[model samples]
Target: MENRIHLGDCIDVLHEIQENSVDLVYLDPPFFTGKRQASSNKDGSKKYTYEDRWHSNSDYYDFIEKRLTLCRKVMKDTASIFFHCDRNAVHIARYALDKVFGPEAFQSEIIWSYKRWSNAKKGLLQQHQNILFYSKTNSFKWNKTFVDYSATTNIDQILQRRKRDDRGKSAYLRDKEGNVVLEATKEGVPLGDVWDIPYLNPKAKERTGYPTQKPILLLERIIALTTDEGDIVLDPFCGSGTTPVAANMLNRKYIGIDKSIDAVHLTNDRLLSPIKSESNLLKKGVESFLKKDQWIEMHLTGLECNPVHRNSGADALLKEKVNGNGVFIKVQKQEEKLNDALNKLVKLINSREGFKGILIQTSNTDEFINNESKSIKIIKSISMQIREF
Candidate 1:
């Protein structure tokens, strides 16, 4: 099998991996939901109980620092990592990451902005999550992926202004141009720190049972823009396995680790039976199978009705028709349609002796199913009573 799941604590499992083996790492660790659940009375809302216990600042820092140190060991010198978190612990995680990976390796602090409910009634709405990107080397691979940033007409036009250089190269115009004119290239605009992807709502199709699961598209953009095919992808806290699935679908090898058994199972199922929307260009064949609506039907005729017939026509049909294997040959215009087509085919096979069957279909059929009986199997397409010897 090309894919396999390893169940254990992320920190312990990460230590077992070879040093400098991974090409990319993307992690979405648990956010520190500080001690306090707001309770609403008739008058107003007030903070009451704590939903999570790991609220102490020191405890939170230590939990992340240890995992990050182990993660650093498994990453290649040229590899890059994206650490995802919310406002609760993003600042702390950033500090820890800088310490482990070094300040000079700091790449980008991506702000994933989304439209969601914010409790900041007294202050500006909290509609964004933070993702700190880091690399082991300064010469790491970087591909600038872009998305349509047009919220309104004016904002779009202002952002859409193209710039080029004298050698017909597309780049941000740095200096004033003389008489030399440059041609605009087709390459899209460079990505910025602030990303505006749609938030996971109740109606979202990608919403699994997990409460904080992210969209596959977000991970896809990150993986595609940063790494190439056949590179290794690592996800230390792989929640529902979104990172691994995205990496595999993009033709990249992956290793995902999660402490939760449920998370591991969720990831396994997601990778095996990924939704159609998450299907990438490489999985076009799988998508085609799901969308197939037509079924193959085979018809056979002209066999002498005898208790023990050798190499007979009815025997041919029995040999070819099997369940779930795509072989659908049947007796042509047989009034004795025994209960179902399947049973009839079985009966024909049992009555015939030394009858060798052949498959007759207009199109090539995948060997999905095969039967021991040597009989004919035909695929159905049109309705016509034709005779066969």
Candidate 2:
């Protein structure tokens, strides 16, 4: 059935759907962690558990293969599937997918990378999971997606047209006069196989405490990449209903099948009103968090302070407060007048009734002028003092 959540085994559920009807399938099945995976709600008032343990590796392989074959039957010839798993089961999962979808149908192995603070058990800490992508055929639907170029990319690489030289080496294309030719505006780089999407935090509003629940943003990317609006998306092992919610938000029809009634109810509840966590890291770019440049760091060296980002008035906050309030630190820019920098620090400190400000004068402009205010203090930078000496 279209846009429905069935509470039953996925294999039996797949039989009811018409052949070649689904456009996309995204499944986050058990990762074969031989334990009772259990977790609870934010307040610990409610708990959920799922069985991922199998009698043997062969039994687990058989279980996965049968469902994968059924899933393939429901997919259209132009459809695609994204199977999500972690290191524990990645090898077995890949083998099953290759056997069912054929080696030729295999696409990319997307690595979903994230950061977590935890003690390492033995070797390297686990920081990534894998999603094996497969197309039902060579003609599968694909929507091209692009991401912004890296911060270190050279400007010439983006703006200059290139050609193969007589030696077959890539060089900038030039006119007969030997002037480099400029190309049209370029779009950002294509989406890569390594995704840096963040994992759901413990306090995230989207967190449902499903032991293996996935972030909705991850599913949204997959749905947007492979299918268009009104396309049918199926999640045979929908745990927290992330896929159905994502599909609905993207204006696509969805079918979610889960054997657990609790999971089915949770997915249905989420469908009524879906909430996605906004990621500042993705919105502002990773470089935005790095506020202190070499100049700021060198000037504030050996000082106990916290560097501030995305703020114009102050560069840092001193660890040692004055009069029970924060001390704002602003390092004068090389091209800025000393008065102009002092005014910015004054404006911010005045806004906070008890706060004080420190202006590290790095420039020589207005060195002899009285620029200190009642709540603001002026100090010469170490370099400035050395140059004057």
Candidate 3:
């Protein structure tokens, strides 16, 4: 199949394609949220929007069903289809998918969990979306992907071989002499349905002013799971062309269809460069990013503050701001001199306008600098106070 973007309704495009030719089909249809989804570019100079409004629930279901049927027609027998949606439409969308692909072909209901914060509504924060994975036949292709095991996983489980007991329960394998048997090799834990990818923050370089634009990392995972080199991938609602970009990156040919002309142009431009934002949080585990001074956290326990990580100068920020500015705090390292800590704090104070700061001196130093010139105030750490007293 040729790699290209088709303009117009996805149903028409899918119909024009030959039957059972595509290897993988992925679609992120509108969620029927009863409103238009609009977002502006980084500088707010341009806007991209899509209307999700529907006359009624039945009308929306029918619309999705027709497109899903068309998508099924184009999928090869060994193909897989991933339909992405949220709570607002997951139920109906799954119903339609089940109708097109037999219920037995329904593979997995993947939870694309992410971290999002919103205080406008009084309820549990919305933090995840769903993707329904279905296949055209029982022999659908699936590439095994393994991820790092969670902290709680037992080492023995990862290293030792296992066997089913007579009662059909899992048990560690043993040799004829009753010695514990170990596996010759191991693949890391199989990737699970529930994912924890970080959402695209406001400053993500991949953002293209398109509403509901998924991260390329998310698409990369899906594409890797279902397709291989030289495989064909399809995205019926290719908003910002994330799927196409991911497909191209993974060495697969892709066909992206979208009704919006601007979306097509944006997708083409992305295909030319394929700029993907590297997520530090995803690259390094969350535990690695959360590494900070435990002693500093203990000292600030009585105060309402949040610990800062991955910064050169600041250690924490007081929840209470001073003079319409964030109050930055830094703890002097045990080996650091008092003057050096003060200098670090001073640099941060000067860099951020309207911000005030404090430095906690943890160790005694022979050299001292007058605090009058600097905006940062110097305070003694509790240990220092006890030693001085």
Candidate 4:
């Protein structure tokens, strides 16, 4: 079945499908946490759960092995599977996957890492989960993907051609004339096994409050990496239907199976209208977020304002509203002309009605302007006042 969710045990549901019909399978099976994982809907109207508790580790292994065998039967020779789990059962799951898919089929052990605010019990915080990738055969489908290099990457490493020296060590290639050789133009760095995708926050639009629900972005990456448009994607343990929704967004056919009736109904309802949250962390690099201006921050310390990043017109916004409108603040730079700074602030304040603007003058090198309006206020910085005296 295409673009449908079946309400039954995955083993039984998978049996009805023909062999070698699916292109991709992504399963987030129970982690054998010995707890009945439960959560409520966004508005607390409904609760959804599934039993992850098993009799023993052997029972868990048996359960996973049987379903994986059935999943393999339905996957095409060029199909792939991604099995998601956490520390509670990754070892046992890996052993089971090796037994069912064979050692040659193993591809990667992807580590999905994210940030966590706090941890009560202390050793090292748990910030990552494992996704074991395997293919039905060696000729599985693949689509090349690339990402920007890290902020710490050396510029020379990217632009210079490298070769192995006599000792087999990496070295920059040089011509017979002793001139260094430049590398050919290149695409970005290839995708790595350790992913830094964020976990779903509480107010994420796609979050259905189902326990252990994954972010749509995470599923989208997995689907895009292995399948093409119009290809079939299957998720046997499709909690909250993230996989199917991701497949739908990418224009691929999808099949989802869950034993919980509520999960099946929720998955269907979500398909009617799917929502995805925008992640600032993914859109902008972490280095950008941490790239705060220390001088600007020091000047606005006692002003009770929020610092704005990458905005040409404003440096910060006042915490308190004036007459039900926001107050945008701009800190004048040492070399910038006074009128030029005023023009930038004026343009922003004029775009909206009732909003006010403040310009903090940090230098006296520019000519004084007598063009302050009712909506625009100009005040000298403490440094400027000290310089004047």
Off by over 4 Å in 1: 35-52, 117-123, 146-186, 276-389
Best by the TM-score measure:
3
* Model 3 score (lDDT): 0.87
lDDT of 1 by residue, 1-389 (tens): 12555688777888788888888989887777654332322233322221335848888888889999988898888899899988889889989999899999999999987766547478878888999999989878787676443334354334444576588887543336533333443343567898766665554556565647787877887899789999888998787788888888899888988766767777898898875243332244433433321222222334222221222223233333334232323432333322234345556545655443333333223444444454544444234323221
Q: Is candidate 3 or candidate 4 better by TM-score?
A: 3
Sort by TM-score, top down from the best: 3, 2, 4, 1
Reference-based TM-score, model 4: 0.76
Q: Flag regions of model 2 displaced more than 4 Å.
A: 292-389
- What overall lDDT goes with each candidate model? 0.66, 0.90, 0.87, 0.90
lDDT of 3 by residue, 1-389 (tens): 36899899998888888899999999998888899999988998889998899998889999999998888888899999999999999989889888888899999999999876566789889999999999999999989999887778897767888889999999989999998899887777899999988888777888888999999999999999989999999999999999999999999999999999989998999999988999888888776655535666756667788777546578888899887789888888757777777777778888999888888777777895778635588888787799999
Clashes of each: 11, 0, 0, 0
Per-residue lDDT of model 2, residues 341-369, tens digit only? 87888889879999988889886773556
Model 4, 1-389: lDDT tens digits are 88899999999999999899999999999888999999998899999989989999999999999999999999999999999999999999899999999989999999999877669987888999999999999999999999987788886668899899999999989999998899777677999999999888777787999999999999999999999999999999998899999999999999999999989988988999999998877787776555546667767879999876546688998999998999999988657898888998898888878989999888775486976579999988997798889
* TM-score of each prediction: 0.59, 0.77, 0.86, 0.76
Model 4 segments more than 4 A misplaced:
163-171, 175-177, 292-389
Q: Model 2 clash tally?
A: 0
Alpha carbon lDDT of residue 111, candidate 3? 98
- Residue 325, candidate 2: Cα error in Å is 23
How well does candidate 2 match the true structure in TM-score terms?
Answer: 0.77
